[model samples]
Target: MLTDPTMWRPAGEMHRCLTDGGSAFTEIFGTPFFDHFARDAETAAVFHDGMAAMSEPENEPIAEAYDFPPTGTVVDVGGGHGGLLVEVLRRRPGLHGSSATRRTS
Candidate 1:
């Protein structure tokens, strides 16, 4: 969707369009982005797999680039599955972290 022409429109216009109930995702896929995922389990799985594959390569680099305090808690809000937090905790022995997001039953 990043490469979609509609996504490249001016920010203000896009926001206005979205506010008016227009969706670039709906235009391309006949549903809003997340709705498309909800409607297609296979596609959602593939998309998540792709994201995990992409995140793995960056985790080590991200872990090394940052310096955490010797002992403190790091909260990764909305970080899916806590991959980065796990890496960070691995590298920083005394640091603690949590990946948290609200989930509906």
Candidate 2:
């Protein structure tokens, strides 16, 4: 998505987007990025895959740094693949957690 020419157009025309009351992506694609993403399963998968890959390194550190309460629910919003939550719950055995999103085959 970042490599797409249309994605770059938004950077160049950010002021126009700000004044026109639309996102930089909407100005270029005639729709919001999420709208486009929702319509294209392949793109959505790629985006999610990228996010999950990028999040891998961060999850370990986050899980290590935080101190979760012994008996409470931890919620991860947009927790694709549940990597972060899994690590967190793994470290804190008694702390239950829920991921907002689940991986799909």
User: Which one wins on TM-score?
Assistant: 2
Q: lDDT values of the candidates?
A: 0.69, 0.79
Lowest lDDT sum, 10 consecutive residues, model 1, at 1-10
Question: Which has the greatest lDDT?
Answer: 2
Tens digit of lDDT per residue, candidate 1, span 11-99? Answer: 43566566776765676667666566777767665655665676888988998998878799999875656778889999998998887
Q: How many clashing residue pairs are found in candidate 1? A: 0
48-104, model 2: which lDDT tens digit per residue?
A: 777788899999999999877888899998897789999998899988998776433
Task: State the local distance difference test value for candidate 1.
Answer: 0.69
Pairs that clash in candidate 1: none
Candidate 2 runs further than 4 Å off: 1-12, 15-21, 101-105
TM-score of 1: 0.61
Worst 10 residues of 2 by lDDT: 1-10
